[model samples]
Every structure is written in structure tokens, then in C-alpha cells.
Target: MNLYDLLARGFPADRSRPAFLLGDGGEVSYAELEAGAAQVAGHLLARGVRPGDRVGLQAEKSVEAVTIYLGALKAGAVFLPLNAAYTAAEVDYFVEDAEPAVFVTDPRSFLAEAQAAAPLAQAVPRADDDVASLIYTSGTTGRSKGAMLSHGNLAANAVALHRAWGFTPDDVLLHALPIFHVHGLFVALHCAFLSGAPMVWLPRFDDAQVIAGLARSTVMMGVPTFYSRLLANPQFTRERAQHMRLFISGSAPLLESTFAEFEERTGARILERYGMSEAVIITTNPLDGERIPGSVGYPLPGVELRIGGGEETGVIEIRGPSVFSGYWRMPEKTAEEFTADGFFKTGDVGRRDLDGRVWISGRAKDLIISGGYNVYPKEIELVLDELAGVTESAVVGVPHPDFGEGVVAVVIGAGDEASMIAECRRQLAPYKSPKRIVFVEDLPRNAMGKVQKNLLRDRYTDLFTAG
Candidate 1:
């Protein structure tokens, strides 16, 4: 039941086939990938990493970094990937919490040592329910909790996404995403591995590099910021993206304007899906169907989704084979997140149609209660985004004198505050309209391009309270 074995079964018969096409026009063959994993596995075993041990990696993205992940899988060790941008203090927290057998900051030296060690011939055996990875939540609210993803959890998700996206050996993926996140690590890499396909790998998302890679690649999976940046560049023409078969967006909400303008510019609709760190990928807009803007489409094949509170719109709860068992070492906290009936409460506020389509409004934490009325930030932001002179907007609730919380709109482009407020007043209820519009050149964002609303809330907490 080892996940490494399942992925290995899909390796190309001709091991000479390219698995990674690097930026320097060099190629890493499938045979080399397998060998690297074997050596790394052996090195981990020699270093006293047992089957259930944790292997923490916080290095920059590279072929060696990916090999470490596969190596950990082969050794039956739980992989813990962290963002490279985290400070020493931040790394300290994860270290004290997860306590990996070996935390490697210098991957190049580690790979050198691994290459010199004896190679393990095959993957170590693991049960289906054995923990495979620990994906820590972003922890905007409190301390980060490690989500325990089992071998069965990851394997089920990998296989489901592989079929849904229609991967084939002939496909050449333009891989520009960071490997730390689920969108890049599990979803993108698994699809390519499952089909024995090659990936035109880039260090990160660069407009020029991505445009050039598009000529030789058939598929591209990226966050919303990647698509928005591409559209901003004049070189990203229809002809440049004409040959691409799929452009999938996730890890953040895609602006409807970005969705429409991308279609207008490239003549291809971006497939936007919804997922989080707890679950790899829960729902996706159809690979072949009407990909309605603002909809995350339907639940994956075996997932059972329901709206909590039994309203048209409430919290989304899900139960499935891919849903993680619980958070690592947080039994009480884990119990609080799941329903009594066993559904994992996805703190996102959304609704499901009778036909099974799902549309996410916003995060439950982001919901604003103003003047004794509930106000959803997404609704206000949607209206603000459509107004003139506004490139984008983020609506957040701040402490107020009159209302319990005042609706404040933080905008990204030029606009008159009074005029914008008047426009909002016309379209929305008085309480729903922004009490103050704070214009900023750019909104605060995390690595994956999701607006850090918590930061926004903190930054403007005194907006209505300052004397």
C-alpha cells in the first residue's frame, strides 16, 4: 500500500525519457529521478530515519528538493515541506513542533552525501493508513496545526486528479509553481508522474520564462497572481498561448475579470478549482464543461459535500477518502473542527446548488457583521471590482464607533472615495456599503497570492476607533 509504489507503476517503460527539462536546456531522465530517490532513501535509512519518522525540508525549490520528497516517500518517512522564506524564528516553531529526524537546510550538500551512499533497491513497505505527510495550516488565526495526511489520503487524491485533468504521456507540463504548496507539490507533480510526462520546470513564475516555456509545453497550472501577471505583460499574446491545452488556476480565488480577460486575450478559459492545506484538492471546475465564473464546480468523484446550518449559504463540510484523518498532536483541536457525523468542517462559507455545483462566497472568518446585519466581503468586493478605476479590492471589517464593525474597502487603484461610496450605496444596503475606502497601491498577500485579510484587518483595526 506504499504510495511510492503506486507512483512508480506509472513510470515510463523507456526510462531514458525526460522527466524534468531544466532552465539551462538540460534534461533529467526518468531513470535518473528514480536513482536519485533510491540513493536519498538509503541515506535517510543510514541516518536512522525510521518508517514513521518525519523528514523536514525547508530549502529552495530544485530537482534535488523534489528528489528528497520522493526519497522520504520511498523510505516510508512523513515529509514536512516548509516555505523557504520563513525566518529562523518561524523555522524554530516548526522544528520544536514536528521534530524531524533530520532537518536539511542545505539540500546540495545533502544530495552530495546521498549520491555517495548505497542506494536502496525498493520502497519500504507501509500500510494504507500510515501517515505520509504533515501539511501545516497557514495559521492566520492561531498557531499552525499540522494536518496528518495518510498514504491512502495522498494516493487517492493523486489518482483522482490524474484522471480528472486527463494527463497523458504525450503531455509536456510547464511547471513554474513552488513545490512547498499542495497545488505545486502533490496536484501538479502527481499528474505528470502518473502519466510518465515530462515537465518544463522553472525556478519560479517568471513572465518571460513562462511565455517561452509555453511554446514547448501543453499544460500550465498556477495561482491567480501568475495569470494576472501574464495578462499584464504585452508579450503574452494569443499566439504564445495558442498551443496550450490547459491553464489551471488554484490556491487562491481567481478574479472574474481575470477569468474573462484571460479568455478574451488567450481564447482559452482558465479552469479554477478550490482546495486547502488540510485536503489536497476537494473540488474542481469540469475539465470539459461550462466553467462558470466564481464557481469551484463539483466535489471530486468520491467526496460527500454538505452545507452546515442547512441554509442556502453556510459553512461547507466534506467527507471523503482523501480528507485527512486529523491534525498532528492536536486531538482536542481536531475534534473541534470535525462534525459529530464525521464531516471535516471546511470553514469556508459557500452554497451548493440542487444540481451539485458549488460556489464559494468567502471564508467564514472573513464574514463581517455590521450594524446588526451580516455582510459577506466577497459580495462587496465583487461590486467594488466592477466599478471604474478599480483594478481590484479587498473588503474587511474593522472596529467601529456606531456599528459593531464598519465595512471598509481597501482598493488597489485610483478612485474617489465619495463617488465609490455613493456607487456602493446605490447597489447595496447602507450598512453593506463601505464606511471608509482606504486606497492602497497593493494589497498584502501571502506566497500563494491569497490576500492576507488578517493583516488587513490588523492594519485597519483603528480606522474607525482612532480619536
Candidate 2:
């Protein structure tokens, strides 16, 4: 089935059934959603979007944005959602590399030099292997690579997740995550769509809004940060959350402390899962079993998981219908990422116990996930290296109380910290920028002269905790 078809498959026989209950108390119904997506599909067609063509969208979170995402799928166009935090320069890299057919920005934005003048063409029938979306993920190499998730990849995961998480039509999802990433658009949206569940939508996460949403909702999926922030709010008591059936966390590892505290406070254990842009979701804690803290749980029904390097802790490798096809325009890099046995190397270090529960130790790629957003050190280091009075910079994710991991910059430089930070803010999205900048005489290096990020992490592991 085309991933787009999932949008309308089980849409209630009653079209008036609410698909989304806006934070402002407005309701968007099934019929309205269908009409809205069809209209936006028309717009994308007018902009020359067609099957296999990449359409880039960088807009703030809104109901209209969701319409456009669904519409792009209907048009058979690959929906590429860029983070709102990315600067124009960062977006240019994606546009130039992906060579998308259409670039859709905010209505007021003048970032696009050429607009699509050609009208829509006939619909292209999409097979299971047809690319559905392009999510750009960079490594420590500093080059952005687009992961091509096929229609089959998306549909398979949605089907598995709906079953694994025990989603049902009666469930009401409290949705607050940004639509740019897999956690929101693919995982969260798909579960809600597949189950015919109504989503209580929030433009962004707010503790008060989540507290209010919990009263009317049965399910919620978020990053670790959400639970931590909600736990901080005294109003989010077990009484207020008793009605909630499940609380899912992913996009970043959930601190064991945060997991224990959330269960203690809400009387519901947070079901933490594991996934990345290349794969929608790989593993998830069971919905109706003992949810072990610090473990991401077993692989989904059809997903295969194994440790690649050793019997102890090693890089996680997975193979499943839900796994993405390959990287866009980089066949060689794609080959390098996969093993000879066809399992995709996840670049995430993990271990699986005899019972099959998976535990994430750390990322093999030195990825910094701040507030559930991926921040590659090379991206920030590139920017820092370009500025004056900077010798070198190394970025690492230190433990944070609320964000799970906060981005910290360790530098060897004479530049003024305030000025360097100002430049970063001007270029980077707020989440990727270093929250704390510490100047050291020199970054710790190994015998190979490579910066030992491990040593840096060890040195400043207490940066946030001590404060």
C-alpha cells in the first residue's frame, strides 16, 4: 500500500470525527483533513511536485503544515522537512545536494531563488520501494546526507508500531513534538493515523499545555526532555495522569533516573523506544510488560537486531522492512554503512541481554542529542573553525537535567566566548548551539593526534550537574 493511503484507510465512517484537537480548542475533523490535504496536494502539483520529486519544506509547526506533509505524500512527492533551527546556509547545502524539484519555505521567506512555474502533471504510481521522504542527517564528517525512507519502510513500521504499542481508535494522543523529524512526523503521526486516534495537538511543548492535555488524552509520545520537564511541574500528579494509557519516549535515550521518577510520579512507566532518521523505529519497551529502565526493549515484530562488534557492547545493526532504502545520491557511503550481511550499521553502540531487551550505552558517531535533536560535532566545529580568534573546537553532549544531553563546546582559542556564541546563534538552530562554552588550554588528544572526545566528555561530565 502507498504510505499516503494510510491517511484515509480507516478514517471514521463519520467524517466529523476529530483528527486533531488544536491547543486553542478548535477541532480538525476527518473530512476537513482530507479536503485540506487534497487542496495542498493541488498546490504542490501546481509547484511541479510529482512522484519521486523532492519537495523541501521549512516552516513552523502548524495544522496547515501537517496538511502539506500529507498532501506531499498524496502527490507522491518526497516530503523533506528541514529543521526550523537551520540557517539559510545549512538549507542551501541540502537543496544543492538533493537538487529538489521544489523548495517550499514560509510564506514570507525569500530564500528560494526560483519558484516552480510548471503546473502539476499526472500522478505517478508509487511502488513499495518508491522514496517517500528525505531526512537529512550528518555525521562527524560534517557533510549532510539524506536518508531515503521508502513508502514500504514507513508503512511497515507504522503497522508494527500500532500493534507493538497497542494503539487503538479509542486512544487520544497528546501531540506536541515538532514535525520536522521522524519522532513526530513518521513515528508519532503514523501511530495516530494507523490507529484512527485523535491527536490533541500543541504547536510546541509546554508543561502547562501537556498537563492540561493529559486530562483528555490516553497516550503521549515524546523525547526524554518532555517527561523531565513535566515531572518538574507539581501539577502533573498521578491523579491527573491516571487516565493516560501509555507514555512513550524516544529520539534520545531516557535517563534511568528520569524513567524511575516519571513512573513514580505519573504511576505509568514511560515506554522508551530506539530509532533514528535512517530507520523509523527499531525497538520499543513492551506496552504491557515489565519496562526495564535504561533498556530500549526488544526489536519490533519484523525487525532484526544484533551487536556487530562484540558479545559485550558493540554497534547495533538492524535489518527490517522498516529500515530505509539507502542514502540519497551517495551509493558508496550507503554501502559503507551496511555490513556484508545486509544489516545496516546503526552507528549506535548497544548491548542486548539474553531476554532480548536492548540497552544503549553511547553513540559510536559522537552524536549529540540535545532536547532530542541530533547535533553533529563537526557541524558546529566547522562554524567555530571558520570564525576569527579560534584555534580549534570540540563539541560534546554532557548530561543535562532537562534536555537529557546538553551540547557543550570545548575550545582551544583566544576568542571572546560571548562573540563566538553570538556567531553560532546567527548560523545554527538554537538546539544545535552549545549551551555552555568552556575554553581549555587544549583539547585532550590521543596518540594519533585525534581529539579524544571521550576524555572531553569525562572531564566535563559534571558541567551541568555541578551547577
Candidate 3:
């Protein structure tokens, strides 16, 4: 069945039921949501959008953003949701690379800029064969490449998630993550539509607002940062969260301490899952079985996962119906990303335990090589987290003349440098321990809450100038 058919099915069951609750605007019923999407589809069709044509949406998270996303699906257009926080240069790169037929924006001012530079020669109606959406990877080390996600890929993922998560008509999702990323757009919102669940949309995450919504929401899916912030909130009480059936954490590593604290207070373990822009969602902690902390549970029903290179440390490759077709307009890159047998190389190093729970070590690119030994930052960060008065820490690799790259730990919290260094020495080997520690007020983070290690590298490079 087509993905849009899921929303269509909801119309007849209970059109009057609340379909979406916007932060600024009031609630929209299922009937209203259907009509809005239809109207947006009509608008796109009138503007020459046809099935498979690429439609770009650059907007803040709003009811209109949700409508445009679903409407793009109904119109059979590939919806490319761009981060509203991205700079003009970043936005230009995606538009030029994807060559979208039409660009949709919240503000009228950006139309002229898009029309002038985008690669598509002429405006034309959408066609199913046309590329749908091109999601760009965050270029931490190199230029960002667009991961081309087809309608079929997205539809299959939504259905798979619907079955895996036990999403039902009764499920109400508290949507706060930015719609730009696949986790928010495809996994959360799409799954909600596929299951006919109502969604509560927050423009941006606020601890108080999110906690308030949890009282009414049945399911809440968010990144680890969101959960961390929620855990830090003073108003976060068990009384507020008793109504929520499922609490999900994704997009980044869900710190074990944060997970434990949340469960202690709320009596619900935050289900940690794994996914990237290329595959959407690969594994999730089971709904009924043991929801293990620090592990992204077993692979979903149709998803097949394998560890390659070595048993203890290996690259994660996934083959599934939910996997994207390839990177957009980059055949060579696409070919390099997939293996001989067709498993998409996740570029993440991981290992699976006997119980089938997956543990992500770190990104292959982020692995630090110091004095002929490899050190995973996640290991050091976890150890530092256990140290007294260390609130948060990020371990990164910096240029070293002798070792090629040396490990550096930038920490955030109140503690004597001697104690922090001593703690690392106790927990890690000499090579694995951070060579230099820098105390920072806060680490620079991307929109998704991932530490911008590249920025950290630049910042510290100047601080530790060569003698």
C-alpha cells in the first residue's frame, strides 16, 4: 500500500479525533489534517509538482511543515526537508546538488534565491521516477553528500516501524525534534500517520512544555539530548509521566546514567534505538522483551544486520527493505557505501552481544589513533561521566606530529583537573587516556545535539599552539 493511504484510512475511522496539536496553533482533527494535506497537494499539483519530483521544504517545525511533508507524499513528490538552522551556503549546496524541481519555503524571501541557483533547468510537474528527497549528511570531516531516499524506502520503513513499535490508533506521539532529520520526519511523524496516531507538535524543545505534553501523550520519541534536558528539568516528576506508555531515545548515544535516572523517576526505561540518514531506523529495544540500557536492541522485523572485519570490533552493515536506494547523483559514492552483497555500510563501528543487542562503539571517522593504538571516544566519555563533578565530556582526536593524532578530552563540569586526569588514568590505559584536557563552558552542538567535534578541534588547535 502507498504510504499516504495510511492517513486516508484514518479519515473514516475517526475523522473527529485529534490528529495534530501544534504549539502555536490549536489542535487539528484527523479530518482537518487530511483536508490540509489534500489542499497542499492541490497547491503543489497546480504549481506543476508531479509524482517523484523533488520538493524542498525549508521551514521551522509547525503544523504547516507537517502538512507539507505528508502532502508531498500524497502528491508523489520526494520531500527534502532542510534544517531551518542551516546557513545559506549549506542550503545552497543541497539545492544545487539535488536539482529539485521546486523549492517550498515558509518565508517568501527565499524563493528568488532558490530560483536563481538550483540546478533544475525548468519548472515541471512531478513524476514518480524523479528523485523525491535528498538528505545531506553533516560534513564533520568532508563535504556533505545527499542520501537519496525514495518513496518506496520511506513507506517500507514506516510500515516496519508501525509493526515493530506496536503503534496503534490509541498512540499519541509528542513530536519535538526538528523535522529536518529522518528521525523526526520519517520515523516519528510517518510512523504516527501509518498507525493513525495523533501527534503533538512542538516548534522546538522546551523542558517544561515537553513535560506538560507527556501527561497527555502516550509515546514520546526524541534524541538523547532531549532526554538529558528532560532529566535535568526540576519539574520532571513521576506524576507528569505516568500517562506515557513508551519513551524512546535516538539520534545519539543515550548515556547510561541519564537512562537510569529517568527510569528511577518516571518508572519507564527510555527505549534506545539506532538509525542514521541512510537507513532511517535499524534496531530498537523491544517493546515486550528486555529493554536493555546502553544497547540499541535487536534489528527490526525485515532488517538484517551484520558485523564485519572482526568479532570484537567491526563495521555495521545493514540490509533491509527500509534502506535508502543510494546517495543522490553520486553513483561512485553510492557504490562505495554498499558492499558486494548489497548491505549498506553504516560507517559506524559496533558489536552485537549474544543477546543480539547492538552496541555502537563510535563512528569510524571519530576513532582516535594515538601512539599506534586506537581509542574510541565513547569509551573515554563514558568513563569520564563516572568521575565525580564531571557533568559532560567529549573526547576528540587532534593533530600530533609523532603519533599522527592524539586524544584530547574537552570536559564540562566542576572538578579539579588533577582529579579528572587521575580518574581517566585509573579507568584507561596510558595510550587511551586523554593527553590533554580542556575545560569548556559548553561544547558546540549541532541542531541534533551531536557535539561538533570539528569545531572543537579548531578551537583547541589554537589553544594548544605549537611551541
Candidate 4:
């Protein structure tokens, strides 16, 4: 099944049922959603879009954004979602790489800019086997590479999730994430149509608005940051969330404390799952079994995961239907990322317990080497998080003349330097503890709320100069 067919199926059976609800505005029924998508598809078709073409969407989270996404699919064109926060340079990189057939933007201010950037391609209706999206990586290493996700790839993953999650027609989803990300676009929006679940889209996350939406939603998916904000609201009550059946957390680590506290307060276990842009979802805490804390749980039905390198610790390699085809026009990078056996090397270091729960240690690149001893920052960060005054912390390896690399901790919290040092020494091993602790007002974060460790490293490299 193609991605657009997911919505087509729902429209026939539940034409009058609500398909999308805008928080401040009103709702759109399944029939209305289909009609809007059709209209948008017609608009693209009239603009000269063709099959196998790439289309750019730079709209905020709303019915229009969702409609444009479906319309692109129906037109047989690949839909490239641009992060609204991205600068023109970043946007230029993706536009040039994908060479989209048409560019759709909100705010109307960017329409001229996008058109100027995309001069050659003419927009028209979409066709099958077209490139669906070119989702760029976070560029942790160097330049961001666009992963070429096909229409078939997205549809298959959505179908897998629809089956795995057991989403039904009666379910109402609270769509609170950014549309540009894979979690919101494919996992939430596409899965809703694939499973015929109605959804309410919020332009941006607001604590009280989310609580109000929860009263009418049966399912909600978000990153740990969204949950943290929701938990901060004083008026939030378990009774309000009683209607919500499934609450999923992804995009970053959901602290064990956050998980436990949320469950205690809301009577709903935050089902922590794992995925990346290269592949959609690889593992998830079981829906029926105990929602294990720390671990992202077992692999989904179609995904194959193995720990490679050493027996104790290795990179998590995954082979699955949901994995992206390759990076757009970057054959060399694509060849480097996957193994000879076809599994994608996720670059993430992870370990599995005897019971099959998988705990992600950290990114392989983020591993800190201090005095020739290897240390995973996530381990130290978790320990620091256990301390009373700590809110968030990032561990990095700074340049050290004698040791080669020294462990440095950049933290955001209320505690004094001495107290933090004592807490780290008490909780972690000698080598794992931070040699120098720097307290900052706030850590630099990406649009997705992930701490930009590279920026932190650049900011704190001076400390290691004298060491």
C-alpha cells in the first residue's frame, strides 16, 4: 500500500468521523481531510508536479501541513519536510540535494525565497516510486546527509506500526510534535491514517492545551521534553489523562525518574521507544508486558537487531523493512553506513539484558576517553541526574596533554560547585567522575531539545588548555 492509501481506506468507512482536530481552531472529519488532501493534490498537479518528484513543505503543525503531506503522497511526489527553525543555509542544503519539484511554505514570507532557491524544477502531480522525503541527519560528525525515504518505505513502516500498536478506528491521537521530524510525520500522522485513528494537531506544545486535548485523545506520542513540560503543570491530574490509553516517549532518553513520576501521577506508564531518521522505530516497550524503564525494550516485528564489536558492548545494527533506502545522491556515505550483511550500523552503543531489554548507553562518537579509560557519558549523566539539585548534565572529553582527553561535565542546575563535585565522586567511579564541572545557565539544545554537545565542547575547550 502507498502512503496515501492509508487515508483513502479510512475515508470510505468513516467519512463523517473526525480525522484531524486543530487545538485553537476546529476539527476536520475523515471525509473533509480526504477532500482537503485532494484539493492540495490538485493544486500541486496544476503547478506541474510529476511522479518521482520531490516537494518541499515548510509549514507549521496544522491541518494544512498534514494535508500537504498527504497531497504530496497522493500526487506521487516525495514530500521533504523542512524544519521551520532552520536558517536559509540549512534549507538550501536540503533543497539543492533533493531538488524538489515545488516548495510550499507558511508565513508567505518564505515563498519567494524558496522559489528563488528552487528555480529549475517545475511542480506537477506526484507519481509512484518517487522519492518521498529526504530527511537530513543531525550532522553530528560533519555535514548533514539526507536519507532518501521512498513512498513504499513510509507506507510499510506505518502499516507495521498500525499492526504492532493495534491502533483502531475509535482511537483519538494527540499530535503535539513538530511535523518536520520523523516521529511526528510518519510515526504519528501516517500511523493514524494507516490505523484509521483520529488525531488532534496542536501548532505547538502548550502544557494546559495538551491537558485539555488529553481529555479527548486516546493516544499521545512525544519526546521526553514534551512530557517534562506537561508534568510541570500544577493543574495536571490523573483524572484528566484517564481517557488516554497510550503515552509514548522518544527522540531522547526518558529519565527513569521522569517515567516513574509520570506513572505515579497519571497512572499511565510512559512507553519509551527508540528510533532514528535512518529507520523509523526499531524497538519499543511492549504494549502488553511491563513497560521497562531505561531499556527501549525489544525490536518490533519486522526489525532485526544485533550487538556487534565485543560481547559486553557493541554497536546496535538493525536490518528492517522500515529502514530508509539510502542517502540522497550520496552513495559513498550510504555504503559506509550499512554492513555487508545489509544491516544499518546505527552508530549507537547499546547493551541487552538477559531478559531482552536493551539499554542505549550513548552515541559511539560521544564516548569519553579519560586517562586511556573509556567511559560512556550517559552512565555518568544518569548518576548525576539522581542527585537532588541536578536538572540536566552533559559529559564530554576535552583535550588533555597528559591524559590525551579529560572528562568534563557541563551541567544546568541550582547546586554549587563543591556539592556537585562531592555528589559525582560519591555516585561515580574515579575515572568516570568529571575532572572539571562547569555550571551554565542552560545547555545549548537543538530544535528537537537534544543537547548540542559539540557546541558545549567548543565552548569549554579553553578549560582543558591549562590542564
Best by TM-score: 1
Worst 10 residues of 2 by lDDT: 110-119
Please, what are the lDDT tens digits per residue for candidate 2 over residues 105-207? 7622321211322322333468999999999874345587899999999989888998898888999999999888888898888888877779999988999
Residues 1-467 of candidate 1 have per-residue lDDT tens digits of 88999998888999999999998999999999999999999999999999999999998899989999999999999999999999999999999999999898888899899987899998999998899999888999999999999999999999999999889999999999999888899999999999999999999999999999999999999999999999999999999999999999999889999999999999999999999888899999999988988899899999999999989999999999999999999999999999999999999999998878998999999999998999999889999999999999999999998899999999999889999999999999998999999999999999899999999999999999999
Q: List ranges where model 2 is wrong by over 4 Å.
A: 107-124, 138-140, 366-467
Clashes of each: 0, 0, 7, 13
- What lDDT tens digits, residue by residue, belong to model 3 across residues 225-270? 8988887887998989898889988888888888898999999998
lDDT of 4 by residue, 163-211 (tens): 7677887788898889898998889986687666678778888888899
lDDT of 4: 0.79
**TM-score preference between candidates 2 and 3, better one:** 3
Best by lDDT: 1
Give all TM-scores, in the order shown: 0.99, 0.77, 0.92, 0.92
What stretches of model 4 exceed 4 Å from their correct place? 107-130
Instruction: Report lDDT per candidate.
Output: 0.94, 0.81, 0.79, 0.79
Cα RMSD, each candidate? 0.8, 11.6, 4.5, 4.0
